[model samples]
Target chain A: MKNILIASTSTIHGSSYLEYILDDLATFFKDTEEILFIPYARPGGIFYDDYTKTAQKAFSKINVRVKGIHTFENPIEAIRNAKGIFTGGGNTFILINMLYKNNLVEVLREVVNNGTHYLGTSAGSNICGLTIRTTNDMPIIYPPSFDALKLVPFNINPHYLDPDINSKHMGETRETRIKEFHNFNTQPVIGLREGSWLHVKNDSILLKGKLSARVFEVEKAPYEVESGTELNGLK
Target chain B: MKNILIASTSTIHGSSYLEYILDDLATFFKDTEEILFIPYARPGGIFYDDYTKTAQKAFSKINVRVKGIHTFENPIEAIRNAKGIFTGGGNTFILINMLYKNNLVEVLREVVNNGTHYLGTSAGSNICGLTIRTTNDMPIIYPPSFDALKLVPFNINPHYLDPDINSKHMGETRETRIKEFHNFNTQPVIGLREGSWLHVKNDSILLKGKLSARVFEVEKAPYEVESGTELNGLK
Candidate 1:
């Protein structure tokens, strides 16, 4: 089976975003020696030895190879050589920038289609959507180029919501932002609130998270939904 | 001379958002009998009465009229005949809904052209843009179509910020969301941080309110901008 781990953070081996998927990751890569790491998403900023070290420590404990893609001068080579890919989150815009700058978006798409195991979180997860319209980051930072990998048909809005923070001072809330998105296009946007993820394996798509995801269809009211459901069915 | 008060709140009567603009509002419409309220931006919500009443009380001392547009069966006539217009804060999507529903978006645009003293706060201020993309609300529940008033070009991302809040549970921050928006569009979006409002009077467009606002341009980096600056120059 193709193994891809698109994680928000690198190590479910310790404190990581995919803690919910640790058992699944371990079970899938039990015989694997190394897991390729794509840190290209954070090309502009300095890595403070924060999550990278954490991911290294966790993967080392499990005898999984942890390779950062930065070492390779060419990003396409790094993606092409990987057995299974693990995408860690930083800035999706930055990630797409590096990917497009090196022209790796197409290669990555092809790799995934070739039945490579794909695992992603946060920024990594965002690339899986049709578009990146739902992201909550500043859109004009010129983080390389704003184009996404286009793995899925809709945009991904990661780290979806915080119920306690008063959205008044911060701007419009998440729900309001997406509704505005809907007004511009007829395509439906899948709003995956935090703690939730969509898992695409083989021909199946599964939804994993605490809260039910919200889906917005143009000219229709937004509604709560779950994963494992087909997006094609809704549109 | 045409008088306009673009505030962050309905009542300079109170609230931190009003402190800087209160005296100016009172002085601008010094001789006006009352301010016409446009609650149409917040259609079908339960908060209109309380919102409209607050402004009524604030202007009550000045004997200013605070009548909601919905009160008149023909809100267009009310707007066309008004001495001044004050748009209160509420869900922008809701407000946009009412604007589209009543076919009053054009009417309001015409009213502005007719030189009616206009005061729009929050949601009201949002409609001033070409598109209300800057609002910090949920995207799920759309009220109506949001074409905005076209008073200005470019989309606005209001109440923008980097993730200062350390809460892990709150999903992705606003920065992440707008970043997603950037990826989808070739046009640069303006990230108007809190305490910032833009004033459009005659040919002069001034960025009012606090310190400096952040500006995001497509395929470029986001930069900090100051008040009294015009948005037209950037586009």
Candidate 2:
């Protein structure tokens, strides 16, 4: 059986890194001893070792050891051998670019499908969908392709923010950017708000956080789905 | 002589499309009677003809007629023979993909180098830089390359918004995004606030409008450059 947790963000307001979701993670990784951490996203350009240490400290509470994928001689072998895998948030382009460079995209997919528990946050979570086109991150680097794991039927727009009516800024809101994506692509998109996540077990995917997620389909109105809602078969 | 106006956005918060810059445009386009409009970045998925009509309505106020480049049977030929050019904003990836698809990148650069007056807003303005890596728009479609016209020395982040102090969102801010870009790319970036623009003529590139732009260089602290500051030789 496949078990995964795809979170919108690693940290929320008034919370330390991964602090809010630590308890949930303890239960999620109860059977696992250690996890291989993919730190290629490097949020704010953090070094891989330092980022891994942060993960190690967080997962310590759950009695799970964390190791950086860069420490291994072969990343593909590492993923296959990992009891659990965690890809933390940063820049999606950088993460996807490194994934393609190391030829780990397929091996990681195969391992996850064969039942290695998986956890993804932010940029990490965005790759669990059909494409990274809906990501809010700036395209700092170009990957070989926009195609992703297709773990879900649609795309995930992580850190999805709602429009602030009182703001003076003129930039396109999150909804506007997604609608523009629908113009050229037919993939449905889920605006996964902060503190929200998708819990995938076997063939079922459920919204597992407190906040409601925004759902968007082509030529239709964008609506909200409450927590605990099933999100499989969105396409 | 490379006469160009690279604006951050088409519309500001209170203005109706192009109202704030009308007087300046009247002077900037004084020598041209007709201008070719590139509507490939169709904001909100608007049709080419309709987007062209919007440009037509705006330019009519300055006594300059607008024509959509799509209407021309030969795009390269139309670019070569144009009196002036205006590339409206929408999605940067869409604009660049279509530009590469039609093989107009070099031709547009050649004509602009030969002194064709050009105006670009948002996505259009983004292409004037070293690359589109700093663009705020979503990557709805993949382009052949992130490379752009290189009309300017650095990248331009249009619709550049400042960090909100009280917001609850956990996504990367514009500055955070640009800092991440600096980690992988060496090119400097200018965050052009809405209603601000860069006026390039011959060898001089000057920031114009009421607001200051944020400048970021690798390994250096980002600083604010006031309006009227020359931006050439920034790399």
Candidate 3:
């Protein structure tokens, strides 16, 4: 009963914004006329209007009109009547904080569960989990809670990178960080590399994009799930 | 008078834990025979006693004995009576969370400001900031607040690294994340590179080690400060 596109990143190396996934996006939103964009994440201090315009330009190629939820007088109502929704990438802390601040958290979830199409990239994708405990973004701001939409049973670690063997930096690797997260949390986590995503429809959650996503569970050796694998049973 | 050695990391590449800064630590802690180790930020799933033992091994080289606070019957009294204190690194959230959980945040700060000769590495150094907002660690656990010891006016982004120009990873770099942090917070932040530290004696905060540190202030271009530069003026 759900139509969601949870992408690891909106942009990748040597590619334009959403260019790599344009075809997939077109098919994902084919049934919709317009989609509401949540530009609260606003990567790199991008203004909300400017961010929305970028999204609009990208969606224009798909013949789907786009509008930022901020433009609405009643955003709750906008979510209620939206044909589809797209939450773009930025800072996860700021994005989730804004979601809770605007009181859009529950309403958006409710509408999406009722069959409103959804799209999330990067920070947006991270919010489609039970909690934001596995996010790779800095805690630039504190949200009211770490709890997320719970759209998926497990958490998402977007823009996931493998440990650089030659680098001498002492910072914890991406895998180590998620493993440390398992020390305090039990939820499964999917480390979604740049071009990967999860396409959830009803009870089926299919891995999209070309890269295999690293899946981590408590007290278990992490393994990779290929592009065509079903990730719905991860929990 | 304050005596503090706030290092960017406890371990560096190809070196034993605390090896890179042992001499500096010996000088910093020369006045004391024993140090109460705040092993709450146990990195890498190391148990409290085991972490204490590791700290003991490092400090033993300087003829100093280390004991974990968890072994104390009254941690508050231990903090008050201890001749010196060392808070090792692990995860900032867990370290700060346990500090708050044990009601030791204010007491530890009080004792340190009262000439407790405090030393902090990595996550420990992060907590000496105005808030734990600038730490590079993953938020595996939620603390009661991001508010930290405020031992200094500015925040510390320990284990700070420059953006990898060659990497195609789409994740936000360390500098970008801090800029985003400035969008919501006003405090100054010092990006302490590995092998770098801030040696505080009373009011003078001197940057120590082999490398320059990055200084970040709101709306200002982040610039490098040489190893010997005084960081007390950041605020």
Candidate 2 residue lDDT tens string, A136-187: 9999998999888777788999998899889878778889999999888998
lDDT of 1 at B172: 49
lDDT of 1 by residue, B83-190 (tens): 888887766766787788788889888878668888877778777766666565433234445468866556666555667665555444556666655655555566
Which rank order by DockQ, best down to worst?
A: 2, 3, 1
Model with the higher TM-score, candidate 1 or 2: 2
**Pairwise TM-score winner, candidates 1 and 3:** 3
Give the range where candidate 1 chain B is weakest over 10 consecutive residues by summed lDDT. B5-14
Candidate 1: CAPRI quality band: incorrect
Q: How well is candidate 3 docked (DockQ)?
A: 0.70
How far is A170's C-alpha from truth in model 2 (Å)?
A: 1.7
i-RMSD of model 1 (Å, 1 decimal) = 8.2
> Interface-residue RMSD per candidate?
8.2, 1.5, 1.6
Residue-wise C-alpha lDDT for candidate 1, range A80-172, written one tens digit per residue: 887777777766556776777778889988898787777777778877766555555432333443446666656677766534454345345
Which candidate gets the maximum lDDT versus the true structure? 2
Q: What is the TM-score of each candidate against the true structure?
A: 0.58, 0.98, 0.98
Error of 3 at B154 (Å): 0.5
Q: What is the TM-score of each candidate's chain B when compared with the real chain B?
A: 0.83, 0.98, 0.97
Off by over 4 Å in 3: A43-46, B43-46
Q: How high is the lDDT of residue A79 in model 3?
A: 94
